[model samples]
Target chain A: MPEITFRQAIHDALVEEMRRDSSVFLIGEDIGTYGGAFGVTAGILDEFGRDRVWETPISEETIVGSAVGAAIVGMKPIAEIMFMDFLTLVLDPLANQAAKVRYMFGGKATVPMVVRMPSGSGTGAAAHHSQSLETILMHIPGLKVVAPSTPYDAKGLLLSAIRDPNPVCFVEHKLLYKTKGEVPNGEYTIPLGVADIKREGTDLTIVTSEIMVHKSLSAAEDVSKEGISVEILDPRTLLPLDVDTITNSVMKTGRLLVVHEAVKTAGWAGEIMASVSESPAWDYLDAPMRRLTGKDVPIPYNRFLERAAVPQEEDIVREIQAIVSNQY
Target chain B: MGSNKINAAYDNEETTDARKKAAELGLTNEDLVSMYEVMVEIRHFEEMATTLYGLGKVHGTMHLSIGQEAVAAGAGFTLQDKDYLINHHRGHGHFIASGADVNKMMAEFLGKETGFCHGRGGSMHIADVTANNLGAQGIVAAQIAMAPGVGIAIKMRKTDQVALVIFGDGAANRGVFLESLNMSSIWDLPVVYLCENNHYGMSAEVGRVSGKVPFKDRAEALGIPGYFIDGNDVLAVYEFMKNAFSHARSGSGPVFVETETYRILGHSKSDRNLYRTKDEINQWKEKDPIIRFRDLLLEADIITVKQVDEIEKKMAKVIEDAVEFAENSPEPNIEDVMEWVYA
Candidate 1:
């Protein structure tokens, strides 16, 4: 395994998939010659040619719609919506169309496409550009939502998302793109609906995903110095949530805290907490499950305000400390 | 016919000329007769659908293409089985003309297990993928946005298959419509954009909703060749589609066609006819495509009055049997509610 950036991992997955299957192609705004807004698709056009790497008009609706269309017609289309916030433009296609087409058509159709949505904040790219919209996509039942927090997870999960016989919404955090980690060079897949426990501990559990996974790990590392062992669980694929790992971790740790960068109100953290509460792991929990997520406000542009809006390592650490102290 | 100014530009005379030269266009009497029969079948099917809706057999409200039979039937004649068709909500006519089985379609409308979608998709979402009818979308302009993908697939597969996307005046105003046209044009993808200008989107008239801009100009602006045709004229529509389909199959990119037809009935089941007067309804009824085509066939000696009567009688029996099959079919099992949600 070679250490590679998350951006390179995603690009490598696309390049490998395209090489393995001619049906696999890339389509989106500036995905061709200009690379992508986040440069995740840089040099892809030169490798694949204009045909495979389609540079589309700035129409997000048709961009996703075309992917659904191509997928049903036996083509693997990986469409990129430059920002997760723009996923709003694609709700009709991704949600009402792609998500529902297979079921609505009585399983006669398969939208085997991947909509690569580069998401989350931390860059100075204000409200319109920096939204963690994975929750919006997760609400749609037929869609498979995956948010990869590391280079290894990004590459493997992307491979699985592209090859999956249904529509998969692959969410990548903008801040994690350049982050480097060990990733296998050729081909591998991390199955959807599986959880990855980054660190093991017995005192408390922090279940998180996307960029927050990295933050939680850092927080757990710092909390270890204070003699509080913490467990970090990342539910990489949010839709088919790995409840067993979450509940089992809670069962061992005896305390649970859900962390995310998305707004606190109706965030995915609530869903995770509710799942744990309903499971047999309920009796094993010695403390009430709590959420350490973003503030209930639109992401601010100011540097300090932005940091304050979402959960940082410090917030996660504080939450872990409070949970261990039996604080509400 | 009375108030519509666009119809004056392209009228039934062009269709009459096409009808006269049907043989010259390599259409035999049998082919012409078959086309006529399809139109009659569509007319009967729509009338039956209307009756079904009235009796509350259809699960949801359906957009009926009652008066616009020729646009669907004529295009159906030109399209091969391999060609793709992306239909709008008002797509029963498009489906039947695309060689859909009436029994399956009726069963779908009735929410029966034997339906094409296994009753998962009712009237608004009927799709026969095996027949290349991609599916009718409930959202306006959704099919327009998706047509280019089918075109891309066709180009990639190196097939001569052309995707015929049928939408309405309402959809033309949508952004995806322009985006799809631009995409298909730039890529030189095989797609034929057929806009059935049935005058109104819902309650708003086409001129009011779309303003003074015609779809032909909009298409031309996007680098696509646009044609304004009389949609009520079956022969004319067939003639235009023959060329449009050929142009698309030849890798010449998409051709935009606006068929100026009228929706004889109200928009949907809930429409109260308050938007327009009965005079307008009766006026479009007189220009009915089925009757017009039948008379043309009769005058040309391509089909006799007795043969026309026979087609009507045959279609009536077909629809009646479809109704019987649908009514008698078993309901979908509750256990399978979540079956098709994935894969």
Candidate 2:
């Protein structure tokens, strides 16, 4: 096992996948020469040459669309949009073309492409660059959305996304890029749509992903003092949600709380709650299921306001504290 | 006015060059008539599709390649199965030219199970992947952006295959089209973006494009060769495409070709026929590609009037048979709605 930064894990996954499959290639703006807007693809161009590590013009639509085209023609293209905000410019290609091509073409063509982008507010990148868009991607029927909180999950999920025969949006929190974790060297992959229970508990079930998973873990520690055992379950892949695991946890704990960095309205938490409510787990609820998400406002540029926009360790602690209170 | 005014005539320098080159190709009367038959097939197919739409047999919206038969026939003739083609809504002609089964295409248009897309996709979504006609997209310039990747794929696989895409002049205005041109040129991808400029994009005229042959501007900026060809002449299209393919095969990079053509009918069935004057439509009909090519063959003694009549009769039967096949095909199974959602 290697203790590597999330950025390094992503780089390793890309390097390993590229080496394993000749059809795999990288395309994006400034991904070559400049490394990347975030340096995730730091030195791939030097290693793979200009053909594979294509440094494209500032054209998001064509970049994604071309990747879709290449993928169908027997090439696996890994396209990067510098920031999550820029992925908006490529929605048509991804939502309309890449997502629908296989179905529209009667499964005759497959778009084996991965679009990677840095997301979430942390470094004061402000409204545009820092936002969680997993909700938007999850809405698309044929797309798979993944947000990994640790270096290990990032490496494994990315490897799986690259090998999967579909379009995958590999979301990376900008703050997690430098966060280090134990990532096994060589080949490894975590199955998509599987949940990882970060810590076992009996009193409450806490479901979260991406950066929020770290916050929820910290909150769990705070609630542990009050004799309230808070279980934290991370559904790494949001689209093919692991309802069985979450439902099983809910049945034991009899309480559930969903947390995410995205805005509260129409967030992915609603879908999780809906799935839980629809399943047999609804009968096990001892307390009302609650969700703590980002406020319904654009993330601000100031460090203090940015912190206020999304949940923090303190906020998560307080929210969980209220959930466990018998009067709540 | 003294130099540039050359109407459609044999003495015109361009047509003369076309005739001379067509002569040098050493094509026999059978070859010429065979090409003529493909054009006839495309024309007949489109005509039948229009009739079926009017009869309420075909569902969803449809766009016909009525007057643009030569472009498809010529490109389809010059292209191979391994080569890729992603076309616009007016792509039924393009697919027919590429040898896509007209019966299945009609079945798809009819929303039948035996259709190219299993009826999940109607006319606008026909994709015969087996023949490598990548597919037809409903979005105007969507395929233009995506088609370049096929070229890179061919280049990566070390194959000489080229990906051909034909879009309307309206699509040329899309930002992705410019991006695609720039990217393909920079990567030297073997793609040819053929802009079918039919004078009008929907109801807007080509004069509104604001630039004189915008493809030239993009081509010059991107350093790719751009050609302006006569879309009504199949021989002219065939000749220019040959050179373009040769350039792509030589790894010279992508090419932009603007085919000056017209749509004989409204853009789609929804068109009220109120946009243009009947006289203008009648004028375009006089220079119809099928009729023009037929006359050329007759004048060159490459095909007899009787032979042309036989092709028309035979094409009518083909259209009739395709209609019957589509009408008789079964509807898709409702239980399989979730199928093909993911590969």
Candidate 3:
């Protein structure tokens, strides 16, 4: 095992999968000769050649469409939409065609394609470039949506998504690309629809994903000083959500708070809330489920406002304190 | 004049063999009669849908493939049970021509539970997997890119089935369609790119908007043989599609069939016929594929006028029955809203 950045883990996953299966290929804008926007597939073209690592036109729709075509023909295509904000241009093929093809064709057709998008805000990419739309993808059926918070999960999840029998939208947080964690060197897979309990607690369960999971975990450590044991649950897969893990955590803690970088209005937090509220965990609740999400507005360019727009460590700590204090 | 007669006599033999082959392939007699009825079935469905839209029975704007019936019928008839088809917004003709349950398609347009997508998908998103017709998409050229993928799957599984992708000339300019063509050609996938060059993309004429090259020529450049055909001639279309399908099934790769056709109605129900000349519209109407095919069958003595009438009556009854079935079907259960979210 070695400490690797989230970007390295993704690159390793591509390298391993491409070597393991000849059908695996990479296609995106600036991915081939130019590496990638975030450098996740940097040096892959040199390793895999131009055939496996395909440089595509600036068209986002074509990137997704070509991937879908290649994937259907038994080529495991890993398509990268440079920015998550640009995903709107190609959602028709992803949501309607790639996602639904298998089910629509009575499980006869499989779009074994992975669409990797660098998502979230940190470097002032403005409103257009920085937005978390994981919930929107989670809303679509027949799609496996993943948001990995660590280098370990990123490597394993990417491998699993590539081998998946359905289309997967792998949302890699733009801010987490350089973040490092211990990632195993050999081939490994983290099954989709499973939740990982990063830290265990009995007071309150903090359900979050992607970079927010790291924020929540850091806040959990600080919140522990005040005698509030915070349980952190990362739902790596959004679509086939780890509802059972989430419910079990909530049942043990007797309280829940969901945090995400996506906007509060109709974010994936709503689904998490609704799921827990309707589940057996409802009987164990000491307080109403709380949601600490990004403010319901475009991410402002100002550093402070952009930081305040999403959930920060302090925000998670304060929410935990409020829940434990039982204060209105 | 007597010497010209000798040359005419010599050419007649080749023409007679072509006619005979076309007849054997269900392009004549009962098959021709059935195809005409199918075209009329789609025609009446579009007209009724248009009327329904005018009366506010339908909610969204719909693109009707009214004059492009032969393209749908001809290409659709070639599809077997295992073959796949991806259609565009003007896809009701494709759906009906491919044997989609008519009433469910109508019910879907009406937003009834009896609709194909259980009323979730309206006119622009009707699909029947049982018929191997992948759903119609509202996005231009999105399905064109996807059809090649299905073709790839068929080829990978060592199946002889082909995927038929139907898009408009407007969609031909889309990057996804071009990329799909490039991939299909390189991989030698079993797919057919059927471009219905109806001369207009909503309001813009194809010649004015397109980059001054015929869509077929573009396909040819991509290493796929492009066949530009009179989409109004069902027999010619059938012959061309058969050859294309064979080439694809035999692993020779994809073919582009640019069917030169027109939309008899406006882009949608709301569109008035103000974009083009009424004379141009009448010209295409005079060459109506359904009527033209009917005449060809009658002239060849493959079918009688009365036989054609009977087929039309039977098809109308079938459509009527489908409508009744849809009307009587139940709406999807409220809990089912979250049912298909996984699996």
What clash pairs does model 1 have?
none
Candidate order (TM-score): 1, 2, 3
All candidates in order of lDDT, best leading = 1, 2, 3
Query: Judged by DockQ relative to the true structure, which candidate is superior, 1 or 2?
Result: 1
- Candidate 3's error at B3, in angstroms? 44
Q: What DockQ do you compute for every candidate structure?
A: 0.84, 0.80, 0.23
Instruction: Kindly report the interface RMSD of candidate 1, rounded to 1 decimal.
Output: 0.8
Query: Each model: TM-score of chain B?
Result: 0.96, 0.93, 0.89
User: For model 3, what TM-score is found for chain B?
Assistant: 0.89
Look at candidate 1 and tell me the lDDT of residue B278.
Answer: 91
Candidate 1, residues B1-343, lDDT tens digits: the string is 1234453366234656434678657888888888888888888888998898878777777778888999999888888999988999998888888889999999998889999899999988999887788999999999998998888888888989999999999999898988899999899999999999998889878776664545788899989999888899888888888999999999889998889999998888788989889998899999998888877777877888888888889999999999999999999999999998888
iRMS per model, in Å, is 0.8, 0.9, 4.4
Worst 10 residues of 2 chain B by lDDT: B3-12
| Candidate 3 whole-model C-alpha lDDT, 0 to 1 | 0.81
- How many angstroms is residue B94 displaced in model 2 relative to the true structure, after the best TM-score fit? 0.7
- What's the alpha carbon RMSD for model 2? 2.7
Which residue pairs collide, candidate 2? none
How far residue A122's Cα lies from its native spot in candidate 3, in Å, is 5.1
- Residue A200 deviation, candidate 1, in Å? 0.6
Question: When only chain A is evaluated, what TM-score does every model earn?
Answer: 0.98, 0.98, 0.98
Q: At residue A302, give the lDDT of candidate 1.
A: 99
lDDT of model 2 at residue A314? 92
Give candidate 1 misplaced runs (Cα > 4 Å): B1-8, B11-13, B17-19
